[model samples]
Target: RSPSYLAAQGCWPGRRLQGSPALSPFLSKCGTFPPESCFFSLICSLGSFMVMLVGLLRYAHVIECCGPSLLNTLGLAAGWICAAGLTMVGNFQVDYAKVLHYIGAGVAFPTSMLFVFLQSVLTYRMAKTRGHYWTGHLRSILSALAFITLVFSGVFFVQESFVLQHVAALCEWIFIINVLVFYGTFTFEFGAISTDTFLVLLKASQAPKSYKSDSSTASTPHGHSHSEGLAMV
Candidate 1:
């Protein structure tokens, strides 16, 4: 399996997200074979919310380091809004809070699509500036796949046929899967930096160790620390 596939080890599949009667009136949320599958809605929603949080945190770190301008700031804000919207959707199920559920979906889906595009641009810029060719190419490809799938998802949203609904459901899943894949690619970016070591250092002083480490260890601007040995695997 691909690394991205492995990263989404426990996420719910595409079919789980297509249960609501409002979206697919013909299909039953509860399947006869398994019996009462409607609860998959909760699974899909919560899983998506968690995945979105990963995107928010990783991209925010990248922006903070590489994106210092007004545009990057706005992009980060949009990313946060997108994450919030996903959380809202998870909390407000369609059966309980129809208005709130749709509202959350409205905010989450579009913002997610927008965030991918913005991240793509950011990646392209970083590739040129920092000479990260493979990362940029991979992100660009994932962004394009996400946009295409999301577009199909939107186009099939208003269709009445079950066939169209099935296609739309698949498209939505592909879109989300691509988003998760893009987030997984951040491992490459993360590998380039010592953020993990710094994070350990930030808390290292609180730990039992009080002494500064030797020169062989990782070196900070101020000095060297034992945490430097903890490389960004």
Candidate 2:
């Protein structure tokens, strides 16, 4: 994601600017996805890098840091797909027509996410159940977005081919928003796991109020077992 690249694209002032996006220069926004998707790649890479760093500092942190894996993975993969599609389109280099590029952008981002979400819902279900249901719900929300964009794409495909050129811009804005939302969840989960670990350590490092506070002092075998189970859980 380079500013220079963006500057190059922006300087072009897409055909959509010529008339309404619906009746622009090119009909198919088909293009090769880039090596790097715009700023979105940088953000995704940075976020993943940070999570890896945190995992190194704490064990099991990666577990918390890694699932909803599908969405995160798809977000990253879609960036590449966009880059490829863009390349195939040439960003209007030979011909200043970008409807194909927009079409690709519109369909690729969310479609990839949908596949990713399906993977998450199916793959990460066990001890993760109560923990990650919301992840599935989020997937559903995005699935709805994908459906709408897909329908719009279909309309453009069949009726208004020119609109396909603009679909990428309008639809991809949602991709940006989706990235933000996913990051927010990632931050929350990281914080949750981190705080949970910190609290457990705080309790462990603190001296027991008195010798009787030790687990061995529990009145009955059942009491000691219950306390142990709580600690393990």
TM-score of each: 0.60, 0.37
Please give the range of 10 consecutive residues that has the lowest summed lDDT in model 2: 23-32
lDDT of each residue in 1-233, candidate 2, tens digit only = 24465346453334222332322323222221234233334544454454334333222333344433444444444445544443433343222445664564455445445444543343344226655676656655765665565555445545543446466446545544654454345453455565655554444346465445666566678887899999999
**Candidate 1 on 23-114: residue-level lDDT in tens?**
23212222212223335445556656665565545555555466444555556667677767776665665666768867877888888777
Q: Deviation in angstroms for 107 in model 2?
A: 8.0
Total backbone collisions for each predicted model: 0, 21
Question: How much does candidate 2 score in TM-score?
Answer: 0.37
